[model samples]
Target: MPALPRPATGPGSRYTARAATTRTRPTPARAKPDIVALARRLTARDLWLTALIHEHRVLTAQQITRLAFTSTRSAQRRLRTLHHYGVLDSFRPLTVSGSAPEHYTLGPAGAQLLAAQAARDMTDTLWRPTSTGRIAYSPWLGHDTGVNELLTHLAAHTRHHPHTRLPLWLSENSCARRWGDIIRPDAYAHWTETTPHGERLLPFFLEYDTGSQTLARVEAKLPGYAAFTTATGTAPALLIHTRTASRELALRRRLTDPARDLGLRLATASLDQTTDTPHARWWMPLEPTAGRLTLTGLAVRWHPLTPATGLEATDADTPLTLPVPPLPPAPHTAP
Candidate 1:
């Protein structure tokens, strides 16, 4: 029989062999929890707690109690609820010798849940009209001082228009769907108009662009509208751009060809950046008949696109009144 080879006999040889074996061994990956499922199981209060955990990473019950303004017992209950629902995985014990204070961490599931909630919140806030049925407006969308000024002006214009009822159809981070297969405008004004026959539906579509000088996203949406017009035989009546003269001029140049091809009408409004009020206050054009108007302004205004329930207007002292035409009538159906 062939002689069996002897194992290497050298100082540190065993250690080297053991080290190689250890290096080749695979480390098990940590298991992540099901965030979506955990979110579904949470109540409103539980969701709030989960959000804090997801944002801050790990929080202790005592800390959460103070931050959430809850009693120690209530905070403890909330923490236990999350852990039981699998929103949180392992917890760190406070100490080895005393009563263990648990520190919570968002499991994989919790992280996923928070992300999905944030996305939903963004979508809802962006597209929905305000509770007051007022026009939706946003300043952050404005790319620069010029664009901001324009938006401010447009907002003012809408507010001052008595003939035009500019109800918010969308705001930043709001969700909106279209009519049938057609692309609808970002914001809408539904007002009754006294036509020769009687009251008729007069819906105005408003589009606000900040003139960030990037039209990639806006241009992509145009094709959908173009297709819709071809199929439905209707196009948005108004396209508004809030931008500097140069930027607006440039947009006009680029959009002129498409506008002509799509049979879309464009409206341009200029905004002044020096003012520190809502853009609506500055840009909205007042009706000729609006002789003596009372304007009430709020320091911080809420989005009009959100559904209102018993929420008073932020500032009633300085209400804005203009001599615009009276609203025709409320739509029988919700927009």
Candidate 2:
């Protein structure tokens, strides 16, 4: 087993922008709203979305809808209301073809509420008035949103499928807090499917690529994951989602030897191949001539992979907290 490498945290995953021009909305200038009043009026989904934005840093309006709402209009209307109330802040990045959807981040009131819920100060949430501006102009905005979209789609899929649940979805920052020393995956997730036979769990580290990095740079990250598996004594599958079919193919060719040599269970998928219902058979194993497999199918293909640990309730009390619980609190029913 290889020794764990020194903590080599890279820049946040780059969501490369294609636009030469960007239009950023001015930061909100209103005084901080009453946290008590805001907290009392927030809906179940509102609080959940707030915490999610704080956890993930940013999510586009469409991504939010997939995770929380039934319709685009309703999601937009409610998100606008949240923005007006200072519970959420949003900005749109301009693109060559058209304007991008609104990207949301935690606002002052939302930060206060989340901190109060966690029994901490607002600073503990790491939010500043300029947080939205920072995220809006981030070079990696596209990459972050891309990574988020994949999980949001999966979450949406589970909403209509009674037999499945996405029990865990941790953003890159959360993964860094736990495993930054050895590896920095774009995101981490735990999924489960309950069938007649039994419950199957698929816990994975997501590497979302935008084709900005060279194939060698991409394959270079494998050793870190290898060391992480050795250090933790757990081997979570590494699922790499590429931006194009050609890139995916080239990457699989480049990574096959290194991944196999490290005894890593890895899979590849392309954005072009994944539909809204992402659980379909889109993922191809790194091995040659292997047919594409569904998300859960990959789990079964690599049986006896160690279940994700250190995410127990007791682990959340540290200075670095656990990721927000995957599912939102149940909607409040009228008494």
What TM-score, computed on C-alpha atoms, does each candidate reach? 0.33, 0.88
Model 2, 1-335: lDDT tens digits are 12122111111233333332233323542676777777666888788788888888888888887777778988888887788777887776655443467778888778888888878888888988778877867877777878888898898888889798898898998888777888889999987888676877888999997777777788889999899888778978999998778778788878999999999999999877895657889999887678999888887888766755556657456333656755567764211
Off by over 4 Å in 2: 1-29, 313-320, 333-335
lDDT of 1 by residue, 93-135 (tens): 2222333234455543455565565544323222221211111
| Highest-scoring model, TM-score | 2
Tell me the lDDT of candidate 1. Answer: 0.36
* Cα distance off (Å), candidate 2, residue 143: 0.1
Which residue runs does candidate 1 get wrong by more than 4 Å?
1-164, 167-175, 179-185, 191-202, 272-335
> In angstroms, how far off is 221's CA in candidate 1?
3.0
